[model samples]
Target: MAQITVVQITCGQCGHKFVLNTSTWPSTIQCPYCQEEMSQDMIPRVKEAWGTASDLNMDFARYHADRNETKFSVDLIAEQVHFPHE
Candidate 1:
């Protein structure tokens, strides 16, 4: 099973918090709440947690269509685990 690290970040614009599961940490993120642009440096990370393969699979399914555009990839054999929301 692949383990994923989920980063909990807050949106600078709306103060909304969200989880991002990715192998590569992004320098910036789009707020899902207000759709505002925020920099990773500006928002504070609440925690780094672990996510299961099933969580990753769900995330993959949610964003699979934009995988190519986002240049994100998931490795089912990944061993380094990170974090998740709940």
Candidate 2:
């Protein structure tokens, strides 16, 4: 099974941080806070965010798995695709 992760995006317009899904990559994305359309230039930002999310997820899973005596499921419970939060 594939591990699900979150991508944090800083809106160019509103400058607010929001969570994005990895599957929504390489597409037209908008900032929920300001409705700013993410241009091609923002691809790099998304990529960086995805990398950070991946690293965090991996670290969290590893930490739990190490401490748990039983099998640890790292599978994430997915929420809405585009959720804007602090």
Candidate 3:
């Protein structure tokens, strides 16, 4: 099993907040609720707002915290080209 860490993210355009697994953190992403694109540069401002636990932040916290699903998925496949038999 892989250790998963949850990170809170915010949409820079519409101020929507959501939680994502750290493994899936990217430079930019779209807000699930408003479909607004967000950049990594806005993380600091979002963090500050979240720290205060404002009304909107509270709403986000209640709805998006530790949700067991992810908005995106990645698949990796590896094949062995050759195998040696003794």
Candidate 4:
């Protein structure tokens, strides 16, 4: 049997978690708990209190992206995180 996993997601606007069954992990989803949508902003430094795949700080990536000498693979942050209205 294939092991199923629960992806803990929280809504940035309402701070709601959605743990449900699906075909696969979605890039994004609306929170059924609060009828709010979630995104990377709602995602904490830690994905689920344990830890996230992303670094605690994206300074390194930002620094690289800012540098003109090296070609940055990642896009530099341009906008601030603005949660959806509840």
Give the top-scoring candidate (TM-score): 2
Order candidates by TM-score, high to low.
2, 1, 3, 4
lDDT of 1 by residue, 10-58 (tens): 6657877787646655566677899887656643442232345446655
After superposition, candidate 4 runs with Cα above 4 Å error: 24-28, 39-86
Model 4 / residue 16 / CA error / Å: 2.2
Instruction: Give TM-scores for every candidate, taking all chains together and pairing residue i with residue i.
Output: 0.34, 0.45, 0.32, 0.31
| Candidate 2 Cα outliers beyond 4 Å, as residue runs | 1-4, 63-86
lDDT values for all models: 0.56, 0.67, 0.51, 0.46
What C-alpha lDDT does candidate 4 achieve relative to the native structure? 0.46
Between prediction 2 and prediction 4, which has the larger lDDT?
2
Model 4, 1-86: lDDT tens digits are: 32223445555677655563443434555787666655566444324432222232244455555763342232222245778983
Error of 2 at 4 (Å): 4.7
State the lDDT at 47 in candidate 2.
82
Model 1 error, position 28 (Å): 5.0
Q: Which of the numbered candidates is closest to the native, going by highest lDDT?
A: 2
Q: By summed lDDT, which 10 consecutive residues of candidate 2 come out lowest? A: 69-78
